[model samples]
Target: MFIRNESFYSFRRQYPIITILVAIHLILFVWMNFLPFGNYIRALGIGYNLAVANGEYWRLITPIFMHIGAGHVLFNSFSLVIFGPALERMLGKFKFILVYLITGIIANIATFYLGGLAYPPHLGASGAIFGLLGMYVYLVINRKDLIDRMNSQLVMTIIIIGLVMTFVNPNINILAHLFGLIAGAALAPLFLIGAKPYYAEQRVFVDHGEPVFDPNRWQKKRRNNKRLKQAFWIGLGILVLFGLLSRVL
Candidate 1:
């Protein structure tokens, strides 16, 4: 069955977080290109050396926003436009935003650490987008029954496309993609496991055309509270461990 235009619009409207992220990415893609040393730094992201040595450490994260060309930006922006809204709708705004930013940062960190800090600058949100794809695959596989009757082959096609793009595109950071995928797959279960109550409440609101249950909002708030507590201790432990390692190593 064809998805109606109204339905698509409704999805976009309901998931403003994704819209805002996509918009920001597009703007940065254009703006970064005009900055001094932007092109040079982006090439380093692919595997250049001189570009990295110029104190372009921020290139790691900046590259996520910098696209090589119009074609590159279009491809990524299109994917985000299509997949991001649906994921945001399923995960809720807060959790979806969390997954996007955290996995992106972790992916960049992993790339830097594993690729070696000296191994040229890298760029592109592909790592994070790949993470989103990984999460989508997890959800689809876990909920096979729900998608079985539809065009499930589309998922397989998308995965194959991603694989091919990873190999054919010289600028792509394969290691970052792999690490981000793992991170996303791991985190997806955490958010998806207890989502049924939220989904049920969402259905009630959608069908009734009125604000009824808000289990999703409540669940998100509770989860954030727990995560904040965990983060505080985790941060403290990391600082202490780092200090010890510095002194000993």
Candidate 2:
């Protein structure tokens, strides 16, 4: 279910919310890394605990789009690309964006309130990405009709791995991850009021004489099983890489 087989243009047309969000992440990453006054931009965007305590309320929201290291931004962006499209399709554009921002904000708020006297400055989309997993978790338990058994297990595994790493890795904002997950699960039912499951329709929806429903979807499903395994390993690899890089960079 997490495999993104669609082309860039096709995926963008199908999932504008995900596209726009990842775009903002990439742009902000560039501005905060390569451009002039990069440190100034980082200072403004990172969720510095002292800044938030002093009533710089925007820091909570800005941190969602800000990142300091290559591993940090790329890890989050890879996750969004893999998982964001499904939720965006399920929730529609407006609701998807709302949930994304709300979860991220909650993550930031937790970081601010619980980081002792001053939490080390932190920024990344990890919280929001976990929020997406939290939503999938809700579906796995309550809305079983939306997700199949394999995908359900996959979601659970990812969450377990993530939560374990959140505790084991001191570099990550643990509160942010935990609170973001809580927020997402708390908000899932309301946002999923009219939600629907995502189907790989982009490739099948042709303009010409070809039929919309491919007669050989079973073959595709078998292929996707292999893809699911590959995606799982790739995801775990990225998370491990990010964790290692976080320690180093």
Candidate 3:
């Protein structure tokens, strides 16, 4: 389910919600890093507890699109790209965006209230990304028919890795990650009522009227992609170990 063999144009056409979200991520990242008022824009968007307490309520919504650094935005955006399409298809565009935004806003609200004076200023799509993860976890638990065995296992593994990283990483908004997960899981039943599992054969658009998959080219790319996926999983496994050891000894 995680593999995206579709062409760039094809993927964009099929998953406009993911496409628009990634585009917003990139655009906002660039805007906050390159333009003259970059710092000003970032300051206005970050989930600063002080600012939120001062009645800057938009901070609740803005931080979902406002990342702190290159790694922050890119990692969250990559996770969204990897995992979002299925839900976008299952929930349809409207519910998908609704879950994302609501869960993110909930996380920011927690950061505002529970955070108080101790919480550092925070910004990133991590909350929303965790929200998506939470939805998948819900599918794995309560809606087995909506997900295959392989994806269910994969979701379990990813959830473990995400939990490890959430605790291990310094400067993380623990409230956002945990609250977002809860909110998504809580909201999943409502939003995923009529959702269906994603399949590779659903739709494959042609690139400018030409087939996107050529036999030989497809084989080569698949082989390379397999290797990359293997390495990625191994790396994540190592992270789980490292995180446990760090906490234990």
Candidate 4:
């Protein structure tokens, strides 16, 4: 439950879940295209009937990490980078991860039950990103004090734009987006009961003569989370280096 209550810009440590997720996606993307077992990884993509009927129920979760192409992955990654930290801080690490997984799985399930099997294999983090946006919208609606008016409007505008795109584009996975949004909003209450608003402004306080940098319970939790975050990034760096070395040799 480590929630770094600081501005996104002021955030010093890498975000644990977000860093690991993006790294995993990038690694998988490279594996699915550049390395062996490319075909097998592509086959792992979620197809409604194919996934469920074949007893590959894990597709419900795995597809959240798979993207169809460069454009698709970039868009979702950008969205996560843009909005994730703020929401993560608000909900705390535990709740933020819980909301993400729950909404993502729900979105996939919705697609599985409602989508036409004729459509291309559904893959990407768009659903989960939409879910995060939806959760923000819920926070804006129910707890206006937790977010400023401008930021709230920005979130609402994104949702509005997404809704419009869903209707306008035939290729879009409207069911996944819709379900993700609903899932995010529906699950918001569970994380918001005692949530505090995060401010983009950082304040420094001093007691007597020294600057206050005390490690309270929450700060200790945050420190531990940061260590985990660093570990993931280090692992990602090593993986990338190995991949590069292999390519060279």
lDDT of 1: 0.61
Candidate 1 stretches greater than 4 Å from native: 1-12, 34-60, 145-151, 196-249
Kindly give the stretch of ten consecutive residues in candidate 1 with the minimal lDDT sum.
Answer: 145-154
Summarize candidate 3's per-residue lDDT along 150-247 as a digit string, tens digits: 66777678778888688876677889999999989999999998777776345445757644645576786578567556746864765555445434
C-alpha TM-scores of all predictions: 0.65, 0.93, 0.83, 0.75
Clashes of each: 2, 0, 0, 0
Model 1: per-residue Cα lDDT over 55-157, one tens digit each = 6555545566556555556666656765576567667889988888767766876776677646655566777777777776776677553333232445445
* Model 2 C-alpha lDDT per residue in residues 1-249, reported as the tens digit of each score: 688878889988988888888899889899888999988998888888887778899998988988878888888888898888788888889999999999999988888878854678888898888888888888998988778888887778878988988888768889889888988988999999977667633457677757577898899889988889888888788777777887887
Report lDDT (CA) for all predictions.
0.61, 0.85, 0.82, 0.72
Candidate order, TM-score descending: 2, 3, 4, 1
Q: For residue 239, give model 3's deviation from the true position in Å.
A: 6.9
- Which scores higher on lDDT, 1 or 4? 4
Clashing pairs in 1: 45-121, 63-124
What order do you get sorting by lDDT, best first? Answer: 2, 3, 4, 1
